[model samples]
Each structure stands twice: as C-alpha cells, then as structure tokens.
Target: MEIHGPGGISGPDRPELKPTEAQRPDKAASTDKVADEVNISEQAQLLEKLSQVPAVRMEKVEEIKRLIEAGEYETSERIEGAARKLLEEL
Candidate 1:
C-alpha cells in the first residue's frame, strides 16, 4: 500500500505482519495476575528497615575496588543471541 506523506512520496506500508518479535518485558503484564506489589506505608516501612542495614559489607567494598583497579569483570554475551532469535521470529 502506498502511504503518501507531506513529501508526496509513497512506499509499501503493511500492518498485518507480526511485530519484530523483540521480547519487550512489559512491566504492566504482571498487574493482571497479582495485587498491587506494595502499599505506600509498607514501602516506607521497608525502606526504613533497609536504611538501617550497612550499605555494603567492608569486604565486598574492598573486593569491588580491587576488581575495578585490576580490571576484572565480565559482560553477558546473550544480547546478540537474543537479537538474532528475535529477528528470526520476525
């Protein structure tokens, strides 16, 4: 189908085709299956409780600093694989 724009050019634009199959994890999907995850008071209480704990263990902090200085880390390689799969689905 030709969909003319203000520029007056036309091209094929079909909507019947499926989405590109990129798995967008919609956050709202959970709403239908579960009650509200947290109430304001409960959330405040939880936040207050969490605030009482030490932010991070000293040993963990040191390990993280050491890793950062030494450049020791890892990255997931699954993104490319997932993209390939989604393209295939499309």
Candidate 2:
C-alpha cells in the first residue's frame, strides 16, 4: 500500500498547479491595515471609578501597625476561624 500527495508524485498522473492572482506576493503586499472601532463609554466609567479611589491610607496602616505592636492583631479565635473556613473550602 502507498499514499498519493497533492502533486500525485506517487501516482501515474501528475497534475500541474497554477497560482491565482490573490496568491501572488505583489497582490498580497498591496493590502492595507484596517483600524478597529472601540467603545469608550465603559472605559470612561471605569476610569472615573478608579480615579475616585484613594491612592493610600497612612492612618489605616499606622493603626494596623499599632495593633501588631500591642500584641492584639490576629487573635487565636480569628486564626482558628480562618483555618476552618480554609479547610471547608478544600
């Protein structure tokens, strides 16, 4: 058993292939790039929401730091609750 390819290289008959106009390099190279249309309404809304957010909160950071320094951050009960929730998820 044998397999015949596109040019019938393995068969008795061999057909000649002709290239079309569209397949020519000169015709292909002449094509132009098209610009895509975009909707800016959603993007503008997202930008407005992002701009409303504060860049930083030094007060919150200082409070958290103070809590840690006073040995009050992350109680054992909170740690156990978080671990139980994680175990439930798994």
Candidate 3:
C-alpha cells in the first residue's frame, strides 16, 4: 500500500526548524564573558544552616528514653528549669 499526503514527510514544503536563542551555540560564547551571580540573603543562609542541623538529636532522645525507662527522667532541677523556661516565654 502506498501512502499519499501533502508533502509525504520530509518534502520541500516543510518549513525548516531554526534553533531557538537558548539552543544557539553562539549564545553560550557571547555569555562566556558575563559572570553568573548568586546572592543568598542572610535569612536564606540562616535557613540553610538550620536545614543542616538534625531535626532530632538521636543521642539526646536515647538518653531521655533511658532515663525515663529508669524512672529518673523527672528531677527537681529539670522541673525547675522547665518552669523557668515557661515563665520566661510568657
């Protein structure tokens, strides 16, 4: 069976595809002299530092777990410190 169409796939009637500005090789050469810049705000840097910090301190958690298991997690000093922090927040 023979298929017949307007241009039969790569005929002269098809418009040539041109490279977009981003795809042009000269675009990169022209931009080579121009240095790319990135300025991170103080808040962004602080947030990045925060991201590097572990969300949970596993060692502290494990220590607390052990203390609680031994019925020694709650102490007068810890209670006083917690109460002080609570009052300070108010």
Best by TM-score: 3
Candidate 2 lDDT at 64 equals: 82
26: Cα error in model 2, Å: 46
Instruction: Quantify all predictions' global Cα lDDT against the true fold.
Output: 0.70, 0.81, 0.86
In model 3, what are the clashing residue pairs, if there are any?
Answer: none
Candidate 3: tens digits of C-alpha lDDT, residues 33-64: 77799999999999999999999999999999
Summed over model 2, clashes come to 0
Q: List the candidate numbers ranked by lDDT, top first.
A: 3, 2, 1
Whole-model lDDT, candidate 2? 0.81
Off by over 4 Å in 1: 1-40, 74-90
TM-score of each model, in listed order: 0.29, 0.39, 0.57
Alpha-carbon shift of residue 22 in model 3 (angstroms): 18
lDDT by residue for model 1 over 1-90, one digit each (tens)? 454667454455443545554765665666456556845798899999999999879999898788778866333545577778999999
Tell me which of candidates 1 and 3 scores higher on lDDT.
3
Q: Residue 58 deviation, candidate 2, in Å?
A: 2.4
**Position 27, candidate 2: lDDT:** 41
Candidate 1 weakest ten by summed lDDT: 7-16
Residue range 1-90, candidate 2, lDDT tens digits: 366566336545546668887776684454578889977798899999999999888899999899899999789987999999999999
